[model samples]
Target: MEKRFISLIRFRVAKAQYLNMGLKFKKLLISFFSVFIILASFGLGNYFGKSQCKVCPPEEIDFSLFWEAYHNLQEKFVDKEKLDIQKMIYGAISGMVKSLEDPYTVFLKPEESKRFIEDVTGTFEGVGMEIGIRKGQLQVIAPLEGTPAQRVGLRAGDKILEINGTSTVDMIVEEAVNLIRGPKDTEVTLTILREGWEKPKEFKIVRDIVEVPSLKWEVKRPASGYPDIAYIKLYQFSEKASFDFSKAAIEIMESPCKKIILDLRNNPGGYLEVAQDISGWFLERGEIVVIEDFGGKKEQKIYKAQGPSQFLDYPIVILINAGSASGSEILAGALRDNRGILLIGEKSFGKGSVQELEKLKEGSSLKITVARWLTPKGELIADKGLEPDIEVEMTEEDYEAGRDPQLDKAIEVIKNL
Candidate 1:
């Protein structure tokens, strides 16, 4: 009986010992996997950290100050609830773009980018005037003829002091544009300082749905016995400008007047291809119309006339002024260089830099100046505008009295031609 009881006790002790060994083995396996999982997770985090930091050179650029400022603003700003991280990012980008000091190179926020698209598509509501920053002042590049701006006598080279009573002292070009544009029939007042005026004049203009027509033509009816001349005014190089120009050219061809006077006085440019197309009407195919200089980094692009010449020897006289720019300047420069046509008026608006629009994330856009415009004669039209063969100045008196001496002089020149 004693031997049986001892055997039972021995078996119970062996079973407890086996259970303890199995538990220890299971704990050891769990410990090993936990360490392995921790090591794997740290390795993955390190790999991703290096990948993200690869974009910025840590050795050369220390973003400590920038981060410090950002953190300080978050900690100290009184209106913490009003702080917009997205707007702060946009402002940072705008500041970076502004550091370039090029007025044409602009960073547009999403809303501003939407308006810019409307501006490019020529389907916006505003006074029909092209505005630009010139000599640190907001200036009117050109006002479309028969538009609200021109009807109110907005001249190119007019320095804008205020828009809608808001001082434009430190206003960006796009901001001023936004203030000037509104729903149709809304009024916007502009305080403009003319060249010869002692005081700035306030001109209240009603905004409208600005529709820019490319070309307008009529037979010039001069007093009594003047030579028959066809008058063609190119307002802008908008969409379908080439087709409209073709139709106008056909009408001019069918007219009795062989001599044509191209009025590019207040034409602020549009499409670059449209300029080339219009130049094709007076230049032979393969003739150089304009040159695109990419700062010698790439081959300078030479734009040549692709279409046939419609008025090669028709003795065309082009009228220009301070308002003539971009495609207008290109056409005037091309016709004068390739066809020996004469230009008569003030120097053109020197907006010759080529801009390319790049769309970014979240419907935002960036417009950067990519290249400069060079005439066929290799004249840089950036700051040095195209000089007319005959320099005719339109004085303030001419404006007040509604006299167009520029057109009159062009008429006189065409008669001699």
Candidate 2:
């Protein structure tokens, strides 16, 4: 997987849907894949004709075109290279998915799909960074902490100009990742254009077996000056998120603090169910956590507080940024709409779409954006992001001065509350 191939794909797509494939991947794979299976295979049933329930034929559709193309490609391919029929079958399935023109709607072939499952669950080898489309350019969301990209000075907001000699303008995150990630000890060169640097810097990053710790917590101590304040940051939404977040909430509750800040910056949502469950801990029973509108019907679910929602009574504030998305947006949106909690930071990442993944036969799958998510007040957050109650953009001067304007504003709001 050369970085150069990723660059060519990136510039071609113009804009792409984001996410990944890996084995640190498995647990995350099963987490989301289970949801997809639950959504797809668990459906009641569908049929073309009337509700005629009868043991019918084995069901046959026209595959004449496929057979024709299969033979033509095998016999007429110009290079006379050997072709694997199995891989070709996978390619046809991949072609079906790509034909949709929806980047999020992807078809992962066997090996890459397997690698995807492994990479996300825990870790594997790669350049060590998260990539996404921001404003139609392939951008690094954030480099994995202590990984090759991070160690090489890759930062959030850095534009990926090229991988090797290929360009990356419109590539989707998935394909780009597949191109960038490889076995350990591989050398991948990245051309980066950052905000402050005048020239696009180049870095030769060595791939390694990267381990991603899903949960990491630090005590925002009374010893550090804010005896009454606690900060909890959740990086990603995974299968165990509900439990992980619950533990964090309990810690806040047991602490001698009157104020708490849940750090959702850089959190790109995961399990919708987990997000709903986590939101449940912040509000009383019967409160609407989120709503979904697929145009066919308005589907909404209300979550009830069961665990330690006792912290809900405290003067609580939420921290969000351009990195907060999906489940993050859902949690933030629920609190702001139902409890009137102040959201402090810049605008949210606004990935307000519900994705439905369909598993095709032969170890490949299709991930498609099925519906757009809405706030409790029916606010849509797809291309347009969630605006904060108090808009505060981070400034380089503020960074140099070692001051957090957003945190200051958040504390001010909490104090007033």
Candidate 3:
């Protein structure tokens, strides 16, 4: 009986050991399948990710040439000490942007980016003048009123041949500007060629801290035969433009002035929002101020006047010149198109493209021309400027004599209106 009981116990222990081995094999199979499935999913995901990559080069464009050049420069180029990777990268980007041939679209290094910011904010130490590229040559866009540039006779449309004896041939606008701008009280010589000049003349100007003014108004009581005309000289559509204009408008409204002369002469434009805000005073609410055209790649953005409309019924004449540009051109176009207000003086400077400043890595930036500006009547203001109703030319003699034939004509026209 004792032997039979011991044999039964041994049989039960064998059955438990067999079940344990079977459970271990089942777990091993499950783990293997799980790993296999996971690896399969990962491989499939990688394949799809490459196909769907947004930044991948297009099939038609081979990027191998660029890599080939880079590798050759790295391996075969002599004078390795002169080869700087960062400078090479910057030069490559600059060349790429320049190839677009859009002068307004440029890549700015860290220091250049800071200088651009200072310029738009209204205060900077320089000979205060706006410069641009026209017909593949550097030209003066406008000289700020009451600044050193104007005092020294730097006129709009003047071709810049040299800066401080450095030839400006093939120099970009920013390069010319950098040569002209200097520390306060320092002098910079500019070689200028006007249309009627016999030869390029040099103008020596001293740099100063430029505080851009927005607008100044005065009531002109002429000869007692004519009605009092409110003359508003708008220097720029700056950050303080709207507020300054509002105060001027209030004062003009209180005064006995029945007509207005808006002098936009020598005004290089500022913010577009400021121009739109100022347009409200003259145009009725919902009247189109300006149109931004993205070449039909995107929906056109139309800016309308949101108005106080204080000067809607007021007879007004605008004064424009070759110096007037951008926001000034927009405002002039809006008023002339909407109200039939006459624009008096020379043609406006055609600088009406919309530039969007994109911040890049390491404090760099790219100012790209995103769109072209169109008038409410669909007049293109880029490259082709606005034509004035009365074509009046200001000669060099008139400027030197402190006589403004443009303002004289505007005052006369507004009186008759």
Candidate 4:
């Protein structure tokens, strides 16, 4: 009996020893796997880190200060819930672009980018006027015809001192646009300072869906018994401008109009391609229209007229004013340089920089001024505007009296040609 009891105890002890050995083996396997996983993760992290570094340009900029500022904001900002990382990133990018001090070069967030598309598409909800920066002040480039702005007496060259009481001092064009535009039926107020105003005046304008016209034409018969003039008023170079201009060209060709009066007054330019396309009707094939100067950093681009040359020999006179800018300026420059067409009106607005819109992540965009526009004769149009062959000024009295002396002068000029 004693021997049987001792065998049982020995067997139990042996079982216990085998269980302990099994636990130790299991622990060893887990330890090995854990170490392997950590090593693999480290290897993958290093590989990815090096690959990312390879894609970036050589690091000449010290970004430690930027990171420090970012971290400080994240950690210590007053309202933690208001901390939007994406907005912070966008603000930083905007600041970087603003450092260039070029108002045309700007950063647009997703909403702002969408608004820009709306503008180029020739439709939007806003007070229908184009505003731009001139001499560091927000100036009215043009008030679209039949819109609230123009109907409310907003005129080209009027300085905008405030939008809804927000001072426009140091305000960028895009920022002012945002403040001025809103849902249809909303009202926006503008504090304007005209050239002759002793004090700034406020104009309250209601916003609406603005459908901008590209161009309008009429056959005008001068009382002086001159040839019928095809009076073409180009409003903007929006998306539909090329198509509209083409239609107008066809109509003018079919009509009995022999002289052309291209009225670009209050036209705040649009697409470069549209300008080039419009120039084709007036300039001979392969004639240089406008030159894109790249500040000697790259090869300059010369835009030549792709001619239908329909009006190449026709008597053409161009009208320009302070509101005529960018694409309008390009067209005016082309006509004067290529064909010696007479420009009659006030000097142009002189916004001659070329901006290229680059799409970034998250539907944002960066509009950077890639180059400055040069007339075909190599005259810079950036700061120094195009001088008219005959300078004509329209006074407030002329406007209030429903007298268009500029148009009358243009008619007179085209009559002799």
- Give the candidate number with the greatest lDDT: 4
Ranking by TM-score: 3, 1, 4, 2
The model with the greatest TM-score is 3
For model 3, the stretches where C-alpha displacement exceeds 4 angstroms are 1-60, 74-79
Q: Clash totals for all models, in order?
A: 0, 30, 0, 0
- C-alpha lDDT of all candidate models, in order: 0.89, 0.73, 0.90, 0.91
TM-scores of all candidate predictions against the true structure: 0.84, 0.71, 0.85, 0.82
TM-score-wise, the better of 1 and 4 is 1
Question: Per-residue lDDT tens digits of candidate 2, residues 77-135?
Answer: 98665687777776777777657765466677666667667765655688777677766
lDDT of candidate 3 vs native? 0.90
Rank candidates, lDDT, best first: 4, 3, 1, 2
Q: Name the TM-score of candidate 4.
A: 0.82
Model 3 Cα lDDT, one tens digit per residue, 247-366: 999999999998999999889898899999999999999999999999888999999999999988899999999999999999999999998989999999999898889999899899
Model 1: per-residue Cα lDDT at residue 87: 90
Compared with the true structure, what per-residue lDDT tens digits does model 4 show for residues 1-417? 899999999999999989999999999999999999999999999778879783564458888988898899888999999998887888899989989989899999998898888777555789888899987899999998778998899999999999999999978898899999998999998999999889999999999888778989999999866689999999999888999999999999999999999999999888899999999999989999899999999999999999899888889999999999989999999999887899998999999898889988889999999999999999999978899999989998999999988889999988998
